[model samples]
Target: MCARIASPCVGLCSTTLGDSVCRGCQRTDDEISEWMALPAEQRDSRMVELDGLRERVAGRFLRIDDEARLEAQLKRHRIRFRPEQPPLSRAVELLRVGRDRIRDLQCYGLVPLEGAVGLTAAELHERLSARLLEEASRRRRALQACTDSHC
Candidate 1:
């Protein structure tokens, strides 16, 4: 049996706030609305695309020292995450859900790197979230353009 594909919703959907791309999950507004009707394969494919972008952006700021430990921490703290998600990308979920509460990055099996240094957890989360939304929006527009042209 195929494993259930998890929705990326963080329960802080900015799409309701009129953003083209949700700052919470980074999904385009249309994707959010159509999520339930999307077939499993399409959901998985879209998840892979989202995970890839998350890892690309989050990797710029953090590194996973141990996936197992990170998973443990996430569960201990009750952070929502998909088991199928790349552990590195799960870092984004952690930052979003626990930004204000997280005190030490090392405890979560993450090492702050690059732009993450010298920033509070909230600050880091904001920067990462902003970048993710920006990229997702750009990608959505590109896809829309392609569709508009029948590419």
Candidate 2:
């Protein structure tokens, strides 16, 4: 069955048939009847039109690719105010946003970096986390030594 032309299924609702198109607002008996006769290109073109109609009736349909592309552009365009911040602070910021972005990239079918080629996002996160921990330990040790010397 075809989904409603006016509304896209957001993985919600149950149909009488496992795959029958929704019989609500947009798709009529005639549209469903002609669907099988349409050519592949025509069907694809129709699908795009149907998507817009669906969005009007339903909410926005956010494809992962759409979000990923937007996010990638945004990340590229972002201007960091404090470029001189210490590595720890930068690492913290990266951990907060970079981790989510990396996950989004992978979800959007972006090819992750090869091990020998370059650092993957996951690899970069691990390295940053380890480096931050090591730096913190060193700072603690230096502080302890300074306190002992003063005492």
Candidate 3:
């Protein structure tokens, strides 16, 4: 039987902080509240959107030669992924594979940040996730400030 899809919550819920989007999962407050009520197909669609957002936010740090190599690595590691997933999404998965398996990210075409070589996979994931949240929070604060000033 196919495994059930899982919610994207990373256990760092920050919607209570007034973020329109959850800094953890990157889901909008509406999306998070309605997730359980949504049908499977709708949930899948929302997951796709979330993946795209993640890809866009983290794209700058990923460097891929092509999708084929990425796909092959993901397959070799038995990681579930869409066939036509974005490069950054695939890269993020590679990062999630943990440090030992992905010791040499350059082999997968991911550009390592200076001094990042010493960090473990989980550490890198946390760092990237934090950066994504920080960026989203910055944008949200800017929008709120603009709205407040205009009103």
Candidate 4:
């Protein structure tokens, strides 16, 4: 009688922008590239390694339940010496920096920020759009200023 084959993975390999994984086995692109040359034992070992990595990734999410408590604590502490909000002129510069970081996150396919400091995918896109608008306005103002001086 033929033996039934064991399944390679769960449905957790949904994202594969930088990796390859079927339901049974998933690996980084570099690992997948060398998979054919690896001995079966080596492949098995890699699967074990991957399982550990997957668990770490899935378990590392920030706890949303604690967010409110943390915010409340900060508000109660009333940290002194808060600066006033910057004028509109400075918003562009701040947005530009934020957009750059967002782009880096998107390009890397993962935000490297610890905990909830990193923007979510939707938030990153929104920040980029806002930055683009800010940049356009800044350029327009600069051009108008230059024209006024020259004319």
How many residue pairs clash in model 4? Answer: 3
Report the Cα lDDT for residue 82, model 3: 65
lDDT of 3: 0.70
Supply the global lDDT for candidate 4. Answer: 0.38
Model 3 residue-pair collision total: 0
Encode model 2's per-residue lDDT on 58-150: one tens digit a residue.
121111224344344435646131333232232233333455455443343233233312555565545544443344344446656888899
| Superposition TM-score, candidate 3 onto the true structure | 0.61
Question: Which prediction has more favorable lDDT, 2 or 4?
Answer: 2
Over 36-147, each residue of candidate 1 has an lDDT whose tens digit, in order, gives 8899889889999999999999988999998888999899988878768998788998888889998888888999897688788899998898889889989999999999
lDDT of 4 at 85: 16
Best of the candidates, TM-score = 1
For each candidate, give its TM-score against the true structure: 0.93, 0.32, 0.61, 0.27
lDDT by candidate, in order shown: 0.89, 0.39, 0.70, 0.38
Per-residue lDDT of candidate 4, residues 12-34 (tens digit)? 34236432333223343444456
Question: Which has the better TM-score: candidate 2, or candidate 3?
Answer: 3
lDDT of 3 by residue, 39-99 (tens): 8999888778768777876665555666677777778887666666677876776675544
Which portions of model 2 miss their true places by more than 4 Å? 1-92, 103-117
Residue 5's lDDT within candidate 2 is: 34
Q: How accurate is candidate 1 locally (lDDT)?
A: 0.89
Winner of 1 and 4 under lDDT: 1
